[model samples]
Target: MIDVYLLSGFLGSGKTSLLSHIIEQFKKEGTKPAVIMNELGKLPFDSRAVEADVPLKEMLEGCICCTGSEKMEAQLQMLLEGESFDVLLIETTGAAHPVEAMDAVYSPLFASKLNMKGIITVADCKRWLDRDKMTPQTRMLFLEQIRHAHLIVANKIDLLTDSEIATVTMQLQALNAKAPIIQTSNSKLPLNIMKKIEATFHEKEINETAIGKQLFLSSRLHTFQEPVNQEDFECWLKELPDTVYRMKGYVPLVGHKNPLLFQYAYGMVQWLPEMIKMPPQIVIIGDQVDRIDVLGRISND
Candidate 1:
């Protein structure tokens, strides 16, 4: 079992700095930690912040709540199959909601492989009290991140006075009564607080329909002697319902005999020719279709 920690904060709230420190600390101790950096757009700037030598997977082009869970699930599954790692760190998009991202991890596939290592919310103390200055959407996103956290880093304390820190910490407590607040300058959170902490989350039951509406993955258990058509595959993808957010797997059409490697993020798709005689195994998860109803059909066909 791996300890998966979700590191969440508003944009530019020093999430990268804190996570970088965590990564570097582990590296010094001769340990490797896997990170899943969730980005809001196609530009994967956040993933570039860490050392490429360490394994860091980037999930870009969709929000964890609505458009990216299927890809996220597939990526996590692939990682679980690899060399054992000490921990999993997920850095959510600043515009994303933490609860929805956490809820998405509770799927049957990841049920036992991962355990919650607590959610950490990093707050910019200087901007913490300026609720009126933020846009409605930004404000909602910030509060939601704080509300679901088990540990909060009231960060950037150097920019604030004692009174300011006290006020902001109180506000955070009011929003998240359960989370322990830590005052920090540059996200100097104590590592001990995060280690072995049991998370307490009173979340709403996630309906599978919501899952279907987001993940578009569907796979079959058939041996295709013939390859699939590139143009026809593209056409089928284009005609799929808008809910199908990401759709690319080891499926081959009629022309190319090899596995037609594909990857779709948001609406952008890429096809790469491959050498591995991969089984025609495909997995699509997003708000695309009823997962069991849709995925099970693939095995039947």
Candidate 2:
């Protein structure tokens, strides 16, 4: 059985850094590990930062817990058929629900071949303490990520004092009393923690109840045939409908010789200097997003 490890955490919570360290450890032991990185947007930044020598898979434009679950299963099937690896590491998007992602792994297609080792959640101490600053929906997602973790890594402890760390630990314990919490800096935890016996994947009644009440999240990929007006695009993005939670893609700006990578989340837009020659396409994810309205606003026409 191919051992599967699901790493869940919020955006900027140090999931990527922890994943890199895990990959290195596996390599040092002479075991090949496959990586699957999920992103809310189509433009994948973290996947590229992982070690190039290791096999990697990108699940983009949606979270595996909801919209990307089917695609995730299909990708896993492909990977199992095409490659030979000792373990599979799935790094879910910050917005993902671990229950949903774990449910996907227990599907009949992978029931026999894949063994879920456990869910390791990495949380930034400061971020966890400041979750009230986020929107209700965003905050719910953040909390839910920790709800089902087998182990909780309270990372960035160096950012807190003894008193603050105590408070953070208490908060995490309140949220999840069962999972053992490991306080660490730089997202590092004892290697033995990862080697623990695989957690039992019980088919809880709540899983069935939640399946019907799952949120509606969909993605739309918009392709631009001509270069887009940078200034106009910025204005449009700033005024995007609240339904659009995340937007990212490659865009050929009017003046730029190469296409630029654009990322938008929680009302913030960032244009990375990284350039690519691929066709201009942007993926937008949200609930009930109107593609026609999005096309009208984003198109330079």
Task: Give the number of the best model, judged by lDDT.
Answer: 2
Off by over 4 Å in 1: 203-301
Residue 85 of model 2, lDDT score: 90
* lDDT, candidate 1, at 64: 73
For residues 1-301, write the lDDT of model 1, one tens digit per residue. 8888888876557787789878877777777888888865454545645887777778876667667788788878877886567888888766556777877667798887798877888877766777556544446666777888888888888877889878898888998787888888878766777674678676633223212242233222233444556665565566555344344456775656678666653345667777876666444433324533333212211
- The lDDT values for all models are 0.67, 0.76
TM-score between candidate 2 and the true structure: 0.71
Weakest lDDT window of 10 consecutive positions for candidate 1: 292-301
Candidate 2 C-alpha lDDT tens digits along 1-301: 9899999876667788789888888888888999888887667766865887777889876667666768888888888998889999999876677877777666788888988888999987877777777555666767877767888999989988999999999989998887889998888876677878367546333332121144444566778888878888888877776556667677888878877887765456778765548657877766556553765655554
The true-versus-predicted C-alpha distance at residue 33 of model 2, in Å, is: 0.3
| Best-performing candidate as measured by TM-score | 2
Worst ten in a row by lDDT for model 2: 203-212
lDDT of 2 at 162: 97
